[model samples]
Target: MRALVTGAGRGIGRAVAEHLSGRGYRVALTARNEDELHKAAAACAGETLVVPADITSAVDQVFDRVEAAWGGVDVLVANAGAGSSAPVHRITDEDWSRMLELNLTAPFRCVRRAVPGMVAAGHGRIVVIASVAAKRGDPYVAAYTASKHGVLGLVRSAAAELAGAGVTVNAVCPGYVDTPMTDTTVAEVAAKTGRDPARVRATLAAKQPVGRLVSPAEVADAVWFCVGNGAVTGQGVDVSGGAVQS
Candidate 1:
């Protein structure tokens, strides 16, 4: 199988790419950072192609390059996303737009671009890395929450549309993950509340019922399940450590 993973330079994306590659899939790693892409490619156990491009605007270019290297992508992991925290009333227009572009619109464009090829081939798997916010609301992150919800809707609708095409679309919604992104969130909360960064980090971890932050590899495991199961389409598989029971 051939796979293309966006934001494959690090964190959940990197974990997914490495996992698929270890399973004998030829993977393509794409992110905005060329150096990081190369480093990620080097860590893959199987063959890899590194394509560095901003997913929001270069979806077509990334797919075209992948198509040229391999026949086409058999698995598409839309895992590139960003989050911003602000009171609902204080959220800026730019921040809202950024969240939507990165979290929702980019995945939609990727799904749209990869569908025709998958339909022709008669089999494919697409997983979007969403969040617990996609399932329920959280304070100080209205824009981020809205974007994740929109992406989950996209996954459900696309899965329904492609149900008969041998294509599966799903979302993996995770809670606070132990990653650089979470580190940023910790720092931001500490700066805002005048609390120690360690305390802020611990508080975020406590939000999950597991009493710890989710691992990138754990989220990758959920993505693997989505790809391996043919009948599990249109579902948001929560990797939130029991924080989300629905």
Candidate 2:
């Protein structure tokens, strides 16, 4: 099987890439950072193709390389995204647009490019690494929340349209993940509030009923299930350590 994972340079995307490759999939990794992408590729136990590029603009190139070698991608994990934390009053138009473009539009563009070949072959899986923000509203980070909601919308619509095409469109909604992104957020919160970084991190983790941040590998397991199971389409699996029950 051939799989293409965006944002594979780090975090949940990197974990997913490694897991899939271990399961015998030929993985293609894409990320903005060339060095990180190479590292991710090296970590894959199976064959890997490192196609470093800004996913929002270079999605096609990533697909093209995968297609050239393996005919078509069996799985496309659209995990490249950015998060921003700002109150509505503080958000600029550029910030909102950037959030939407990176978190929502980019995945749609990748799906648009990958769907045709999947439809032709009668098998494919598209998994988006959305956030728990997709399901509920948050105080700050309005743009990030909106964009994630838009991602879930895209998944539902695409899944409905591809009902009988053997293509599953789904999302993994993680919350307070123990990744670099969350660590950055913790630092930002600590810096803004005059609280110790450890305290801030613990507070964020406490939001989950499990009293801890979800691991990147846990989110990757959800992605792997979505890619492998044909019956699980149009669904958003919450890997949020019981933070999101619905």
Candidate 3:
């Protein structure tokens, strides 16, 4: 199988590409950072294509590059997103726009570009990397939460639209994953609360019954399950270690 994974330079995106490669799927990795993409590609088992572009701003180019490289795609993993926490009064237009573009609009564009080819082949799998914020909104990240909530709705809509064509679309929502993003947030918390980074991270982990941040590979495993197993569709499976039960 061939798969297109967005935001694949690092974090969960990188893990997803590596996991798919290990499963014998040729992976096309998309992201804005060329060096990171190359680094990630070097870690994969199967052939990996690097398509460097900002998926949030230049989705059409990304789609064209992947479609041209692979001829068509069997799977699409819209896993690139960002997190922003702006208070209700502190939220700026740019903050809202960038968060929405990165988290929601970009994924939508990837799906839109992939479905037609999938329909032609009569089989396709789509796995969107949503977040626990989609289900449980917290303070200071209203816009980010709203964007992920949209991702769930998009998955539901496409599940119905693509089911008849033998295509399945699903989402994986993870909470407080242990990645660079989480590291940055933990550091920020440390700075704000005047505690050690480890303490701040531990406090966040306490919020989850799992007693730790989810691993990138764990989140990728959930995405792989949804895409590799065709029986599941339109489902938002939580991989947050029971942090946000739905």
- RMSD each, Å: 0.6, 0.8, 1.0
**Model 1: per-residue Cα lDDT over 109-207, one tens digit each:** 999999999999999999999999999998999999999999999999999999999999999999999988999999998999999999999898898
Ranking by lDDT: 1, 2, 3
After superposition, candidate 3 runs with Cα above 4 Å error: none
Worst 10 residues of 2 by lDDT: 56-65
Deviation from native of the Cα of residue 134 in model 2, angstroms: 0.4
Score each candidate by Cα lDDT.
Answer: 0.96, 0.93, 0.91
Candidate 2 structure, TM-score to reference? 0.98
Residue 177 lDDT (model 2)? 89
Q: Model 2 over residues 75-120: C-alpha lDDT tens digits?
A: 9999999899988999999999999999999999999999999999
Model 1: weakest 10-residue lDDT segment is 201-210
What TM-score should be assigned to candidate 3?
0.97
Cα lDDT of model 3 by residue, 1-246, tens digit: 899999899999999999999999999999989999999999999898999998877878877887788788899999998887767789999999988899999999889988998999999999999999878879999999999999999999999988889999999999999898888888777887799998898988888898988999999999988987888999999998888877
lDDT for predicted candidate 2 compared with the true structure: 0.93
- lDDT of model 2 at residue 244? 84
